[model samples]
Target: MAGRFFSVFSRSLNQPFRSRLQGLMNYGLSCCVNALLQSFSATWELVDLLDRWNPVDKYKESVPLQLRKVLLAMQSDQSQPAPHQDFLHCLDRNYIRLHVQQDAVEVFLSILNLIQQQMSDKALAQEIQSLYKVTVETYLQCLECTYIESGTSFLLSLPMHIKESHNSLEDCIRLFFELQELRDRDNCYCERCGEKKPSKQRFRNSRGYTRKLHCKVTFPETLNISEILTAEALSQSYVQSDSQYSLCAVIVHSGDAMFGHYTAYVRHKKDQSWYYADDSNVRQVSWEEVQNTYGGSEREGTAYMLLYRRTPEGKQQEWSSG
Candidate 1:
């Protein structure tokens, strides 16, 4: 529950479970998880990787197993009650309590880490990880000692700061990789001088986080982050990696800090159309309608989290149901 981490941990505020989540054997009263489930079902790549995992022994309390099951159930003929009743048991074992407000981004990260840590097949798990992995190189330089240490790391969800009034997703992503001077509380330790000192920091590549800002953020249905990758990140790739991404899911948080609701705009993999999933109720929607979540006030919803898929250059997106 996002506050991994979106700042609105109170987004759930222990709210009532919304709509028995597809009116099936829903997972206790967690609309947050319900919304997340919708997004997960939309991610065909994740489903593909999870489906490939064949473990020698299956653990009863495994989150990935339960996730795989629930995702599969979600795709079954909607006429029958989906087998999500056991979802409650899985959450209980993992201590992912219900009836609580959780941040979407935070939950997203937690689930990703759970897959990484709990998967029985490490190789397949890494394949799942690579789908959302955002690799970056961090350069840290201490001002006083002029000692510099650089290392490569990766973020499952790149956190970016948004503007108060207006924002463009690209600009925010650019700023995420920009240089920053750390001082005072943010100062770093100087290895040579054996003391703390102000340091300059920069990231080679990255992206943003949500802070419940009631502002307008403009984004595209298909996103190309190639231009936004920092000079260092681009150099490292240097025409090797494709930078195009397709928006697959959007987790929307409606209402304000005290209380809220969670919904999702998912682009169906096979159907190739947007659909608004509100627990038990799901309806077709347009890209323009999806943009309504770009927040202008606390009363309305804003995109709390997003899921994008990397698309290879010059290739048509995977549109088949297989």
Candidate 2:
């Protein structure tokens, strides 16, 4: 009897509320009602004030120079707390603004000078380097996303502190070069389709026991391998009359130490990976050995070499040079 009475009382309380909720939802006024109901709370009032005065950008652009000067000073002296109170008050709104301000030559120079004053603190220099890289990457990404062309060259222009104990901005720049290349190579083309070689058609060829592929870019050399083999291997099972030649070149991708070891075969004309030449013998092997084993005579040009490799998932990949 008590259970039945409670069920009836519950339905009595919920039915009208349920009806009102259904009506509000059907009319698409639920959200408006919710906002009005939430207005009773302080949090909602704060949000309302923020919405009414979206002045974040204004605050950034209007930062007092006196405070900035103090920051520069503190940044220079590691013994001092970098004045965070005034800055942190505007934290969420002013971060982007502060970052942009820091990009200014004057601002950066001030900070740089401050950092120079604390040159004895190797840890501090390393910290600054990390911050510098993060800033550059963040700026680069934002520019790329926004399609802003101007700041793209800023990375090449920024002066950074070099420390013997830490990897500097130069190292990051080199890595960026290699990464930029891989990004450039994200597209692929099928070699079977050809009509005068598309100005950049790719091809595949075999050299000795290895296969190679390449982009049909011209190189600066040629050779006759079998004619010189007696001077090389002493006997000729490994050397064949029709043995194909491969040539490779070292291209420093992005003006960094990371070089593209390009190798490709001349006869069948395919691209290859660098793994074939990455050997103790191969490294010790001279250009003469390269010529005698794979090179063959051509009228006035040099034969190319290509290298091939198996990828982590068992796919074939190739890289070429010279």
- So what's the TM-score on candidate 1? 0.84
Pick the TM-score winner: 1
Least accurate 10 contiguous residues by lDDT in model 2: 1-10
Per-model TM-score, in order, reads: 0.84, 0.18
How far out, in Å, is residue 257 in model 1? 2.9
After TM-score superposition, the amount by which residue 135's alpha carbon in candidate 1 deviates from its true location, in angstroms, is 1.1
lDDT string for model 1 (96-131, tens) is 767667777777778888888899799998988787
Regions of candidate 1 where Cα sits further than 4 Å from its true position: 1-27, 144-147, 203-211, 230-235, 238-240
Question: Which of the numbered candidates is closest to the native, going by highest lDDT?
Answer: 1
CA-lDDT, candidates in order:
0.70, 0.24
